[model samples]
Target: MGTRLRLTAVATAVSAVVLVAASVLVLALFQRQVTDNADDLATSRAEDLAALAAAGRLPDLLTDIGDDSVGQVIGPDGSVLAASASLGAAPAVTDRLGSEDPVRIDLDGVPDDDETEDYRAWLVTAQGPDGPVTAVVGTSREAIREDVLALGLALLVAMPLVLLAAAALLWFLLGRTLRPVEDAHLRQRTFVADAAHELQSPLASYRTQLEVAQRQDDPAGWRAVVSDLLAETDRMERLVRDLLFLARQDSSASAMSLVDLDDVVLEEVARVRPTTAVDVDVTGVSAAPVRGNRDDLARLVRNLLANAVRHASARVQVACRQDATGSLLVVEDDGPGVDPGLRDAVFERFRRGDPARGHAAGTGLGLSIVRAVADRHGGTVRVADGGGGARFEVRLPRV
Candidate 1:
């Protein structure tokens, strides 16, 4: 079943149980009140009959005894001396009756029919003019049963309507609550598809190069093909590492510590200098501290430096410092700066405003990684204007 239907079923079952419990409680309370009333009436009737008989006078005990009420005066020998007209010549319901406590009795075959009756009755023994006699009074339980059945029927009619309304309201609210998650899932699917398509380019190149190398008979041609193949493999490895780092940062946001921005910048610049001839200048450094994962922040700096080194005409400058707002890092190169309109677009995955930097220059994920790292650290990166070339500025909250 769908979520809505499943939730509705669960809610309906719970509401049904609650309704049933409430109905049973109400029924019990009503039954108790009716029983108490019946017992009091029966006991009062039995006491009045005993008092009249003991006074040696037969008053109006015969008055209004037809209200489903039965009373009888038993002689000292368990023989009936006086009784309501409805119970003519009937013996005591119980054989051993002495106290005036109320008792429940089931009257079956009272009128010689295939039916049974229920009653609450009280019995007492009192001194009479003739001798000790037993006084008994009782009333039928038909009225209590009728009220209880009526209540049950009313609940049976109303419960379904209440449950349906509640289910409908919950379905609407839950749909509204999960909409953002649904949108994110769709976006993730699209991202995966885009990533797969991007990855296919390098793999197809490797296959074509290898297939050609197998057919080429010249040793120099095979060697050249092998070198180009290794370059493509390096590109794929970098792409994989970038994807993994982004995924890890996405999954682990709380694993962050205080990071020194100046150290991160100087370290990346030094690493790049040993591998390339680009003149990387480091100038801005004055207590640029922030909170972030050390490895991820290092990766971010490396990407920025790599991007600069790949595209810089001659020199790349790395700057880091803390300001009143936050920590700032800027990587500027003297190559052709990006188009003003394409600055934001370059930070998207697989986006390369300077694809001329070649396959070996870097994966197009450099700026995207920079942006992702900044975002993970509760910071932001944007392409800001430089003096001559592109300047990528990063700002992160200070520790």
Candidate 2:
């Protein structure tokens, strides 16, 4: 069975057992209480009759003896003396009489008109004007049985409905709870497939280059082939490193501390200047302190700078400063700007910017990493108009 169905079944089964036990207990307690009430009534009636008989004031016909009950006064010779109107000249109710002051009995086939019924009877003896007499009082068990039966029927009908409701509620809640798990599973599968595809190209190129190099004997040709191999190796290493970093970010929380955002920006700009001809302008840089993992913040700055530098036609503007709400960092490049439509898509893993704007040189994960770091630090990153080029903005809460 499916997870939802299995869980629902288990939960419903437990509820069913509990409900059945509770219903049975309720019925038992209710039956006992009603039976006790009936017995008490019978005892009370019998005592009243005995008191009357001992005083020699007993009536020929017993009256006001309560509902669904009968009373009889029997002589020592087993002869009926006085009886409830319902008994109507019947013989003695029972021949089994004990010498005890009072006794209770569960009797079946007690005369009720032409038919017989069950009763709970209480018998007591008292001295009359002439001799000792027995007073018997009993309440029918039929009403008690009918009441218990009705309750049992009600529970029998309601239990399934309640169980069905509980099961349906569990099914709905479980589906909602597992939705995120299902989505994460889907994302993991997609990520693995994409990673494999990304790694395949460089591996194939590296193998083909190795095959070509094996056929060459000239040292110069071999040196050139070695350069190509080194470049491919560097490409693969960068891809692997990026992939591992992303995976780590997914599974772990980074250590955080107060970091200087402008310092990171300037350091990355300085690093890029020595490698690229693009003019790196940090004239707009200012102090912007924020709390985050220093290494991750540095990576975020590095990726933004790398993306701008890779695409910049001539100049890249870097700026960081403190604002009322938090720190604001902006990087703008004088290159083919990102299409407004592709701005959000650029931050997705393995997603690249417009090819008409610039060559896609990096592993296409730089922007993704930038956004990931920003999010981890409770910040937001977005693309905005940069006059003639693309502008990336990051906002982080102040420490």
Candidate 3:
């Protein structure tokens, strides 16, 4: 949030600077055009008057420019030849240019305190009969100043409104985009609480059964009951372990490492053979290295083997080989192959195929765990036809 606020501030500052620059450009263009128009008008009038003075037609030309604008002509000695009353009584061009260079000056010709005030002037020059004549054309400075002030005020008002609108848009878009993250967090929290509650019941039942068996007088029956309870406890433990492994896979903090594919498969097959008919057959096994958590990869292999053993009639076959692309680990069972339509569904959590066929004892999380581990390693698992049995294949990239 702090970073976003800072970004918003930076955006506003950049917008303000850009708007101010545009307004400055507009104001400069307006001023240049206005001043150019004024200069052209004054120069044209001065030329007309200079021609009149040369032809001795001052009265006629002066009448022609009666009430248009203030005008004045000055000689080499800075003396005014003819001046207009549109310019109120004030210092002549000669007086205003008292020691300064004879340049244009924008100022009032009359005291602003007086009513019916005339505020105008134009300093100019022309070719007189004896020498070059100087003329001063005058106009009101108040109107020009007001126009500039109004331009500045408009820019100042409009810039903030634009920035405010932009900031509001940015805030709304950020909120909407991040809403999914909030929902994901809420879902995870709910899953954790539910998992804890689900785990408590089985654990409590196992503990009660064990305590009752321990206090019984006849030891043989109690021993068998205690053994079954221990088995149930171990099943719960395995489920919890599988759940923890999946939770870690979901977390963003986890990482993978390069592992030997052949070694992982052999090790897991050896680990599960102590309790089942686990057979590993690697005719052309590739010693390819892949990126994955060694422990999760081993667990994935174990789960696939365990699932096969639990349902196999006679044996489980494990094969590791490579193709043109990457390494492949195939676990085949001589039991009934999964139905063609149900292959994809078998990988889902708690999914059992044709429960009427056989009651296979499993927590139903094994294949799901296998899929998650394979996915984290940038690999995939699929079930395909294996002649007369089920074939589970895990394919991973060679690193």
Candidate 4:
């Protein structure tokens, strides 16, 4: 069965066992309390009757006894002298009698009753007008039985409902707890598949070029094949490097320190200026300090600059400044802006925008890496309209 079902079943079974044990314990205690209370009441009544009999003040009918109880004062000859109204004209409730200590007996019913009702009787002996006599008192057991039966029925009805509720709550909490894990597992699978697909292209091209170079007898033709092989090798190397960087991002525990965000931005811009004809504007740059791994932050800045330079029509603008919330960095390119539908998807690994936006030379992982670095630094990145082209913004917390 599924994990949630298994967990719920185990938890419910434990609850059922505990409930059963607790119910049995409570029932046993209740039965004992009820039985003890009845015995004490019967004993007290018998003692009072025995005192009256000793004083030679016994009457023909006993008084002050409960309606469900029976009392009898028996003579030495076993003849009933005084009896409670419930047992009118009946013989002694019990023949056993003791003088030093009270005798207790369980009987079906009194002599005159037709129905077999349960009773607890206490017998005590005392001196009477003629000689020694006995005082017997019996209390009905129906009330105690009724009380116990009511409690048992209540628990029988409530236990299932309680278990059902507990199971439902447990299932809901387990689902909530496992959702993120399931999502991460799905993402990992997708990432592996995409990485394999991306690598297969370069590998196939490299093998084809090697085979072609093996057959080429002309030195110039061999040179052409070697160049093609080198280009494919370079492509594969870049893809591998990007993949390794992403893998490390998942498990890296890099230390953090105070770094100037604007300085990183300026350095990346200066490095890229020599490689591209796109104009790199640094006029908007300002000192923006943040606390994070300096190398990762530089990578973030580098990726953003490279993406802009790769797509920009002629000029690329870079800006960095401290804001009320934290540090804000923006990069805008004047090339065809990202399609509105693919803006969010661009940050996803291996995701590329429309071909019209010139993604031919890009690895598609640069934007993904930019997002990963921003996220690792407890920041956010988003794409917006840069007036004429796409604007990428990165926000990080201030030191």
Give the number of the best model, judged by lDDT.
2
lDDT of 1 by residue, 354-391 (tens): 54443445567788888988998889999899987889
Q: Among all windows of ten consecutive residues in candidate 4, which has the lowest summed lDDT?
A: 107-116
Q: Write the per-residue lDDT of candidate 3 for residues 1-399, one digit (tens) a residue.
A: 654566667777887788789889998998777666665666566567666665555641133443435666565565555666544333355554322223556544444435443434455445556766655665555555666788778878887898799888776775576556655575488458646765787778877777777677567778787778778878788777777777767665545778888898877777777876545455545576777778888889888888888877777788887677788889888777888888888887667664532668777778988898888878899998895778999998877
Off by over 4 Å in 3: 1-194, 200-229, 252-258, 277-286, 339-342, 349-359
Candidate order by TM-score, decreasing, is 2, 4, 1, 3
Candidate 1 RMSD to the correct structure: 6.7
In model 3, the Cα lDDT at residue 305 comes to 86
Extract clashing residue pairs from model 4: none
Winner on TM-score (2 vs 3): 2
Model 4 clash number:
0
Model 4: CA > 4 A from native: 52-76, 109-115, 124-135, 172-187, 207-226, 248-254
Misplaced by over 4 Å in model 2 are 1-5, 56-68, 75-77, 98-102, 109-116, 126-132, 161-165, 168-191, 212-222
TM-score of each: 0.64, 0.84, 0.59, 0.83
Q: Where is the poorest 10-residue window by lDDT in model 2? A: 91-100
